[model samples]
Target: MPLSSEPKLISGNANRPLASAIARRMSMHRALNVELVDARVERFNDGEIFVEMFENVRGQDMFIIQPTSNPANDNLMELLIMTDALRRSSAQRITAVIPYFGYARQDRRAKARTPISAKLVANMLTEAGVERVLTMDLHAAQIQGFFDIPVDNLYASPVFALDIKHHFRGNIDDVMVVSPDVGGVARARELAKRINAPLAIVDKRREKAGEVAEMTVIGDVSGKSCIIVDDICDTAGTLCKAAETLINAGAAEVHAYITHGVLSGPAVERIENSVMKSLVITDSIEAPEPVANARNIRIVPTAPLFAQAIMSIWQGNSVSSLFDHETLSTIYDGFYSAS
Candidate 1:
C-alpha cells in the first residue's frame, strides 16, 4: 500500500469517535492503506469555524465523516467549510460521509411557504464542492433525488437484523416487526422480511410536529414480541405511545430499532418511563450523555459498515454486496460482542 494511493479520512467535531472507528477498521485489513487525515477544525471566539489540514492532500481522495445531529447548524457548517478547504487544497475527490443527515425530516414543503431544507442542504454540499455523498437511512429515501451527485443511502436493517438474531437466539416464532406509522411500513417490512417475522403497523395521526395522537394497533400483537422499526427517533413521543398501545393490545414485549437516535427534548426521560423493553439504535448520530446512560437503550457501531462501503466505493466494487449476509456476515457477526 503506497502513501499516494491511501484515501484521506477526515472528521468534523460532529462524531469524532465514529470517524476514528472507521479509520481503525479501514486500517485493520492492512492491505488497505486508508488513514485519517491529520486536521484541526476549530471555532473562533465569534463562533466562526476554521479548518486546517496539517498534511498535504493534493490529488488524494478525501472522505469527510460528519453527522449533522445536535447543533445541526454548527456541524453542517463545519462540514461545508471542511469540504471547501479540501477542495481548495486540490483533493482529487471529496465525499461527504454524513451518517445522520439533520433537517432530513424537513425534506418536503409541508406548508405553503416552507422551504425544503434537505434540498437546500444538497445544494450547499454541492456548492461546497463535494463530489459524492454517503449517508445512511435518510428520513425520506426520496431525498436522494435532492442531490445532483451520486448518493449512497445505506440501510441499518442488516445491522439491526444481526443484533435482533443474537438477542432472540434465532427464535423468531413469536417475533413481529412493527412500523410506528404508515410512512415507515417499507422500512419495517424490510426488517420483517430479513428476520422472517410478521409485520404490524401502528395507526396514528399527528396534529403537529413532535406530537402524536392516540395510536391504535392495526395487527395482532397479542402474545407476540414486537420490534418497532423507523429511520429516526427524535422526541420518542410516537415510539413511547406506540409501545403503550402495543402493550395494551396484549403484546408480550415491545422494543424499538431506530436508525438515528436524535433523542432530543425529553426523549431519554420519555423512554425511561415508557413500556418499551429495549431501544436499539445505530451510531449514526453521536448520542448525548443521557442517551448513552439510558438503561434500556443500546448503541451499535456502524463504522464497519460505512468503512466497507467506502472501501468498495474507492475500489470501484459493488457496495451493495456489503449488505448481503452471505458475503459479509463474518464481517458484521461479532460487531456487537459487547452487547
Candidate 2:
C-alpha cells in the first residue's frame, strides 16, 4: 500500500508499546517529529486536574494513539489536552485512534436521571477538535452515531477469528462460541458462524458493577469446548462466572476471547480461580503487571490489523474486505491451530 505523505502518528504515555508495535507494522519510526508534553497533573489545595501539551503539530495530519484504559480519567485528559494542543498548533487534521474507548458502556441513559456519558465523551472529543475517530470493538455499536465526525469502528473478531482458526485447526465442530451476556450475543454469533461452531449465551444478571450472577446457559454447551467472547473484560466477573456455568454445563473446557483486557481490581485473581482454561485478549489496552504475569492470560497483538486499516484508509481503499466472514474464518482456523 502506498503511504500517505502527510500521515503522522503520535502516541501518549498510555500503551506506548502498542503504538510502537503499530508504527513497526506501518513501517515507520516512532513519530519523533511531535512531542507530548507531560501535563504534570497535580492536586492544588482542593482536587482537580491541570493539563498542558509541550509540542507543536501545525499543518500535520496527526493521529493520537491512546487507549482510554486504566487511569481512564488521566488518559482521557491527556488525549483532550493533546487534541487541544494539536488544534492550536494549526494541524491539518486530528484523528483519535483509541484502541479501547473507556466509559463506552454508558452510551445511553439507563435510568430516568442518568447521563449518557459516552455521548458526553464524544462531545468532548469534538470540542477538543478531533476531526475523526478510529476505535475498535465499542461497548455499544450505536455509540458511533454520537460522533458527527467520521468514525471507523474496527472489529477484533477478525483478528481473534484468525487466532482461533490457527489454534483449533479445522475441527470447529467441537468448539462452541459463547456470549457472556445477552448484549454480546451478536458478537458471539458472528464469531460462531465464522468458525462454523454452534453459539451459546450465558444468561447473566449484574447485581451491581463488578458483580455478576450467572443464571443459566441459553444454548447447549455440553461436551463442547467453549469460547466466551466479549468486547471488554474489566473485573472478569462476567467472564469468570460464565466460564463456571459453561463448565458446569458439561463443557469439555472453557476459554475466553475478549477484545480489550481491562484486568482491573481482582480480575487477575478471579480469572486464575475460575474454570477458564485460557483467556485470550488483544493488545488494545495495556495489560497490567498482574495480568501479564498470570498463567491463563494470553495476549494477541492487534498492531498488524490496525496498521493495515490505517494503510487502507490512507490509500483510500475499501476496508470492508477486512471484515469478510469467509476470509476471517480461514484466518481464525489457521491461528487457532498454530497457537
Candidate 3:
C-alpha cells in the first residue's frame, strides 16, 4: 500500500450519510468505479440472517464502511458477508471501516462464565477474510488486541476538542473537564490537558447494569463550568446523574463530550430533562431520530480524520502522528477557533 494509491470505498446500509461525508472529504465521486452492493438482509422462518452482496470486486483494495451500531447483529452480518464477497471476488485487501464498533462494551467477561462478545466479533471478522480494521473510540481499548489483523483504532478527541474550543473559546479559564467515572479518568485527563484546563472526576456507584446512583465529586467542580468526557453515552443515566451532582456542587453549568452517542432507551428524553447544558457527540454512529432532533445534542464530523487515516494507510505512511494532540491542534485550529 502507498499514499499515492487510492482504495475503493464501499459502504453498507448503515450510516450512509457519514460514509458519503467521508467519501466527499476524500474527493471521491459516488459512481467513480466504486460500488455499494445492496445487501438484501432478511430473516428466515427460524429467525436466522441471510446476506447477499451484488457487486464485482476483483483485485480491488476494498474498504467497507459499515458501523455495527444499532441492530448490531444485522450490521455485523452484513459486514461479514461483504468481506466474504470481496474475498471470493479476489480483492487484494479488505478493511472493515467500522466507525462505531458495537458489542465493544462486551470486551471483557465481568462475571463468571460470561462470554467475551467483542473477541468473538473479532474472530468472526478474521474468519470472514478481513485483512484489517479501522474504527474510532472503541468502548474498550483492549478490544484492538482481540483481532489478529492490524487494527487502526482512531480517536475522536481531536474532533471533539476542536468543537469544544470553538464553543467555549473566551471562557476556557472557567472550563473543567470531568470524567463521569473512575474508568474514564484517563480520557477526561487527556481532554483537560489538550485545553489546558483542570480535571475532575465523579465518584458514583452503579447499582445495576443500566442504573447509576450519584455519590460525591472526587475533584473540585464548584464555581467552575464542567464538561464530562467519556467514550460512549448509552441511556445517559451516568452522564445526567453526574451533571446533577456537579450542578449541586456549585458548578456554573454542565456539559458532556461523548465520542459515540448510543442514546438507547430513554437517553434523549433523560438528557432533555437532566441538568446537562448540552451533549456533544461525534458522527461515528448514525444518530437515532430522537437524538438527532434533540435541542441539546450536537454532532461533529469525523470524516476528515478518517479520510486522512485512509489516505495514510493507502500511502503506506505512519498514522500515529494523526493521533498526536499537537498535530490535531494544528490541523483543527482553524475549524474550532472559528466556531
Between prediction 1 and prediction 3, the one with superior TM-score is 1
| CA lDDT of every candidate | 0.88, 0.80, 0.83
Winning candidate number (lDDT): 1
* Per-prediction tally of clashes: 0, 20, 3
Residue-level lDDT for 103 in candidate 3: 94
Query: By how many angstroms RMSD does model 3 differ from the true structure?
Result: 2.8
Clashing pairs in 1: none
Q: List where candidate 1 sits over 4 angstroms from the true fold.
A: 1-4, 207-210, 336-339
lDDT of 2 by residue, 1-339 (tens): 433354667777678898877777566432333233333434446545444545545666778888888799888987888788778878788889999999999998877999999999999999999988989999999999999998988888877777787777756679999888888889999888776788888887767765664468988888998999998887887778778888888999999999999888889999999889999999999877888889999999877667766656666677666686454443334334432
Q: Taking the tens digit of each residue's C-alpha lDDT, what string does model 1 give over 1-339?
A: 223477789999999999999999889864666667888999999999999999999988889999999899999999999999999999989999999999998988888999999999999999999999999998898999999899998889988888887788645788999999898999999989887899999999778765775688899999999999999888898789999999999999999999999998999999999999899999988877898999999998898899988887777767787666445566675664322
Superposed by TM-score, candidate 2 places the C-alpha of residue 99 at a distance from the truth, in angstroms, of: 0.4
Off by over 4 Å in 2: 1-4, 28-56, 205-214, 325-339
TM, every model:
0.96, 0.87, 0.91
> Quick one: ranking by TM-score, best first?
1, 3, 2
